[model samples]
Target: MFTSQGPSLRELAVQALSSVERGYDLLAPKFDGTPFRTPDRMLDAVEEALAQEEGSFGSGLDLCCGTGAGLGMLRRLCRDRVTGVDVSAGMLAEAARAHPEGVDLVRADALALPERLWNTYDLAVSFGAFGHFLPAERPALFGGVHRALRPGGVFAFPVGAPIPVTSPLWWAVAGFDTAMRVRNAVWRPPFVMYYRTFPFGPVRTDLERAGFTVETLPLPPFGLREDGSPRWRLLLARKPAAQYG
Candidate 1:
């Protein structure tokens, strides 16, 4: 419905009625053509932000990496292995088709990531998938990511400015979340997606509780809101490197 190449209205309705994993499986082929795909401008901005960090890394991981939108950037930053993990098999297949080489695409849940992920990865990133996770699930999600990384590995993602109540977009976002909640209430296999669930304050606290030292950097490419606050911020969650006596 978004464009000629994007999924049709009926396709989107079918996806919305199915579980999140099944929905993405149906949408995988045309996912990139849809607005759901993270924009290259945002990805490039993130890559630029990561570059300013400590020089080249040994490996990188794209947590919940969807169609692998961030994989190419991870490939550019990490000197060695680059991997993409997602719960959706169809999404991984699309990622594999897109990346073709220099990436290990694994199918796994972000909330219950495998033990094999321990102490691995110098960097990890995710984009536009936060809405899939509910606020109550943050602990498991963050804790799993905490365990997935090696000492000193960084996890980064962007946070857009909170929509002001006066803005039309605020109502639109609120309405969408309301609709999703209603849909989930009656549906058997709930399609979990909500816009307002990932507030930064709770999220930062969750990350810190999960063992990350968290901070934020403004992404200037997206510019500032009228209030002078940044329109977007890059959240960095760093795991402390191992120390010994």
Candidate 2:
């Protein structure tokens, strides 16, 4: 998927060898040209789904927003304000350049979001950034998200169905994950990205533990798998509004 516009294999290898934040910094300028950027169709599907479900939002947060891919979608979905947060300064710079007028880009770690942002957003969403977090980090990451949203606000993201053992894609991802493990083992700074680490069941549990009531809705555009399950589902986790007794 590397066009002349995209990063070459050697550049990608250099990025892979660096830390996650630094790697993303190096990849920022051409991030949108790379396959790692979320596809437009997936963004449109999510925007459409949220439009149908929540109707609208006051303020929205894009968690681990890489190069502001989903910022425009959040802008249309949220009437008041839209913010994109990521740890990489270079990615933020690219996002700012692309979305100069309407978007607010923040440089911050997703796991330890600033307290100033607590209870600030009415909706939160992330795309293709889960792999950076280990399963152990979900609690802190989710708790931060849970705290970021206003009571009754929803956090939404898409999850693909597990690849069956029979699928060649499954073997490919497995091998990729194995290679990553080996690389991290030998590397100085660990770049914690794994394709198979973010399973829905455990992630749902983590969300529940972080005080979100979670549910899933099928994203029909991606179609169904052989067993009739949706190939891609939108995971909607909502924080319960406070009660006045």
lDDT of 1 by residue, 1-245 (tens): 26688899899999999999999999998899898899999999988888986567888989889898999999999999898999889999999999999999989889988888777888989999999999899999988888878888888999998989999999999999999999999987999999999999999999999889999999989999899999999999999887210
Candidate 2 per-residue lDDT, tens place, 109-166, comes to: 9999998888889899999999999999999999999999998899999999998899
Error of 2 at 106 (Å): 0.8
Instruction: TM-score each candidate.
Output: 0.97, 0.98
Q: Given candidate 1, what's the lDDT at residue 142?
A: 89
Residue 67 displacement (Å), model 1: 1.1
lDDT of 2: 0.93
Worst 10 residues of 1 by lDDT: 236-245
lDDT of 1 at 197: 95
Q: Which candidate number has the best TM-score?
A: 2
Worst 10 residues of 2 by lDDT: 236-245
After superposing candidate 1, which stretches have Cα over 4 Å from the reference?
243-245
